[model samples]
Target: MTDPIRIDVWSDIACPWCYIGKRNLENGLAVAGQDDDAPQVEVVYHSFELSPDTPVDFDGSSADFLAQHKGISIEQAHAMNDRVSQIARDQAGLHYRFDIQQHTNTVKAHELTHFAKEHGKQLEMTERIMSAYFLEGRHVGRIDDLVALAEEVGLDGAAARAALESDAYLPAVRADQEQARGYGINGVPFFVVDGKYGISGAQPAEAFTQVARQVWAEHQV
Candidate 1:
């Protein structure tokens, strides 16, 4: 019998393509799991922040941050964001409101994801964080906001708050970062399929489906 395929995904909540990639992976999973011969796939999400130096309370919008940091005009930033939004909307069913998104550091958010992983709710936490950042425009860098998001996902609000305050999952977050570095990964939305194959960017659903089947076939041989 072939072993189940385990995929480790390294991504950032603030990354627009991460969410799109996640959705594409899901779409691929649906295709891959259509037959009894399909390999059972297990997914694990790891921490990867795009902008570690961003302030918690940037005195500007997400577009403003992009404009300043990327050395582009505000109009150009808006155009870029719009293009991404259109892709996300058409391809992933995600509504990205970059204009109102809070540009902030994601380390704390990564720490909270680790916290959720301990409770076996890592995927749920990941979805919520990405949705909050891209769609709801929530402030995920703040403890209060993170705690609220945790509670919304059926986690203990007080425990989440305490975890953040004490930096309980900081080490785990760092460990994930170290692993990413060891793998020579320097980008977001990167997927490691069965610890062997690496898939980069928000690839189409068929790509993930093909990988799953190929890996399964190789394992069974």
Candidate 2:
């Protein structure tokens, strides 16, 4: 049996491109599978907080936060987001509602993802949280909100809440960040394939497809 390709992904809950990159990678893998023998794949998500200092309840829209963070005008921030929104819609088939997005510190959300990983619902949990943040405008920084999302993904809500309350998974989140630092990765949505190859940022589906095929072919040789 062929060994599965392990992809370690570093992403943040508030990152719009991370969601789009996830979709593009999935789409690319699907395309590759159709063109050749489908390779088994294992994806592991790690924590990367783009704005660790952000408050749990930011007092403005995503655009306002972006404006401040990037030191740009609110109008420029909106224009930047507009371009990204269009790209997300066209490339990843995702509808982003940044106007209503709750810009919050993702450390707690990252902790929840670690909790979900322990329960074998990491992927579902991550996807749901991203959707909640970018699409549904749900709060992801609070324990209560995260627990509700965990339940939506078929996890035990109470257990999730308990885990968050106890900071049981905060270590795991910190560990992931430490590892990212060792890897010299300072950005979200960074992809590491098979412990060697690094693909940064949100590339097109073709890029993922090509990389998957190349890595698979090399491993077989």
User: TM-scores of all models?
Assistant: 0.96, 0.97
Candidate 2: list runs displaced more than 4 Å: none
Number of clashing residue pairs in every model?
A: 0, 0
* lDDT for residue 71 in candidate 1, whole number 0-100: 98
Q: What is the C-alpha lDDT of each candidate?
A: 0.91, 0.92
lDDT tens per residue, model 2, 98-189: 88888899999999999899889899999999999989989999889998999999999889989999999898999999999999999979
Model 1: ten consecutive residues of lowest lDDT: 32-41
Q: What is the lDDT of residue 133 in candidate 2?
A: 92
Q: Which regions in candidate 1 have their CA more than 4 angstroms from the true location?
A: none
> For each candidate, C-alpha RMSD in Å?
1.1, 0.9
Model 1: lDDT of residue 24: 95
Residue-level lDDT of model 1, residues 10-74, one tens digit each, is 99988999999999999998898996797788899999978888898989988899999899999
